[model samples]
Target: MASTHYTPAQLALHWLSAAFIIWALVMGFSVMLLDVTPTFKATIAGVNVSLSILFIPVFAVRTWLRLRHLRDHGHRPGERLAGVIHNVIYAVTALVLVTGVLMMDRPIQVFGWVTLPQPITDPVWDHRFHTLHAGCNGLLGMLVALHVLAVVKHEVVGKPVLRRMWVAR
Candidate 1:
C-alpha cells in the first residue's frame, strides 16, 4: 500500500485545521472591515469567541500531534528546514490567537443565550492590545502564504513537501 503516507487521523486533522483556519481568517477580516456600535461589537466578539473556543482546542491537539512527528527530518535536510518553518508558523499562530483574545473590548453573548466574562478590564490597554493583535494577525497571514509557497517549492521543485501530510509515503 506504498506505506500509506498519512494515517487517517492525521489526514483528518490536516484538512480540518485548514478549513478552520480559512474560516477564522474570513470571519476576522469581516469583523474588522465593518464597524458598528458597541452593542454590535459585542455581538461580533461573541461570534469570534464561539469560533475561538473551537479553534483553540483543535489547535492544541494539532500542536501536540505535531510535536511527536520529528521523524520527518531523517536525512535529506529539507526536513529540518520544514521543521523550522513549521515552528515559525505555529508560533505566529499562537501569538495571533492569544493576543486576539486579550484585545477584546466587550463580552461574549451567544445571541441572548449566555454571557462570557470579559477578560480585559482596562479599555486603553485593551485597545493597545487590539492594535498589537491585528498586527500579529497580519504577520500570521504572511507566514501562511510563505508556508504555502514553501510547500509548492518542495512539491514541484525540490521534493515532496506535502506528501508527508497528504499522501503518507
Candidate 2:
C-alpha cells in the first residue's frame, strides 16, 4: 500500500528547509546585484552560511525519513519521475552547501551566536568552489521551478498532491 501523506515531522522539515532555501537564494542574489557595503555583504554571507549549515542535518533527516516511508509503502504511479526530481534536488542542495562552505575565506559566524573556522584557506580552490556554488545554485533554481510547476500541474489535474506535504488538519 502507498502512503497518502507524509508524517508531520517530515512536513515540518520539508517546509522549513524550503523556506530557508528560498531566503538564502534571495539573499545571495541581493548581495550580488545590490551595491551594498562590504560590512552588509559580510552580514548577509554570514546568514547564508548559517542557514546552509543548518540545512545539512535537516536534509539528512528528511532523506532518511523519505527512504523509510518508501520502503514501507512502496512506490505509487508517477512516483518514479517524482523520486528522480527529488533526488536531484537533494544532490544539488548538497552541492550548493558544500561549495558554499568551501568557498568561504574566513570563519562563518551564525547570527552572532556561534563561530565556525574555515575548513580551507586556499584562494585558488576557494575561487573554484565559489564558481561551483554559483553554478549549482543556478541549477537548483531551475529544479525548484520544476518542482513547483509539477505540484501545480498535479493540482490542476485534480490530483491535489500538495496535501500530502502540507500540514495535516
Candidate 3:
C-alpha cells in the first residue's frame, strides 16, 4: 500500500512553524496587553520580529513541499478547501512579515546577533505598515482558528487527517 503520511522533515517543519507562530502571536498580544516597560516591550517585539524573519524560509519550504505533495498525490476528498486555506495562510503570513519589517523605524537586531536594515523610514509609512500588520495578524488568527477547528472536527469524526500530518510512518 502507498504511504499516506508526510515525511518526517515535513512534519518537523510543520510543528516547528506552528510553535514559533504561536509564540510570536502570544508575545505580540502580550506586548499590547501588558503594562510593560519600553525596554521589555522592545525585547518582546525583537523576539517576535526575529521569529517572523526566520519563519520566511521555513514557510517557503513548507509551501513547496505542500505543492509537491498535491502534485504527486492529487487532492484527496475535501482537500480543495484545505488548499485554499493553506494558500491564504501563506499569503497572509508573507504580508505580515513584509509589513512587520516595514513597520520598524530602525535596524532590527535579532537576539542581538544580527541586524536587519529597516525598509521604511517615514513615520507615516511605518504607521501604515503597522496597521496592515495588525490587520493581517487578525486575519491569520481567524484562519488558524478555522484550521484548528477543522482538524478537530476531522479527528472527532474518525478521520486520520491529523495523523497524516503528525505521523511519519
Number of clashing residue pairs in every model?
4, 0, 0
Candidate 1 regions exceeding 4 Å error are: 1-6, 30-46, 71-76, 110-114, 167-169
Q: Which candidate would rank higher by TM-score, 2 or 3? A: 2
Give the residue spans of candidate 3 off by over 4 A. Answer: 1-3
| Predicted structure 1: lDDT | 0.71
Instruction: Tell me which residue pairs clash in candidate 1.
Output: 5-167, 5-168, 5-169, 6-168
Predicted structure with the largest TM-score when compared to the true one:
2
Quality of model 3 by C-alpha lDDT? 0.82
RMSD of each: 4.1, 1.6, 2.1
Better of 1 and 3 by TM-score: 3
Candidate maximizing lDDT? 2
Candidate 2: count of backbone clashes, pairs at least 3 residues apart or interchain: 0
Please provide, for model 2 over 60-146, each residue's C-alpha lDDT reduced to its tens digit, 9 standing for 90 to 100: 898798789878986776687888888889889889988988998888777778888988889999899999999999899889889
- Over 46-128, each residue of candidate 1 has an lDDT whose tens digit, in order, gives 67677775677788888776665445423333355756877887887788788777777777554556676778989998998
- In model 3, which range of ten residues has the least summed lDDT? 1-10
Q: Write the per-residue lDDT of candidate 3 for residues 48-129, one digit (tens) a residue.
A: 8887788878988987987787778766665778778888887887788788888998888777788988887899999999
TM-scores, in order shown? Answer: 0.76, 0.91, 0.89
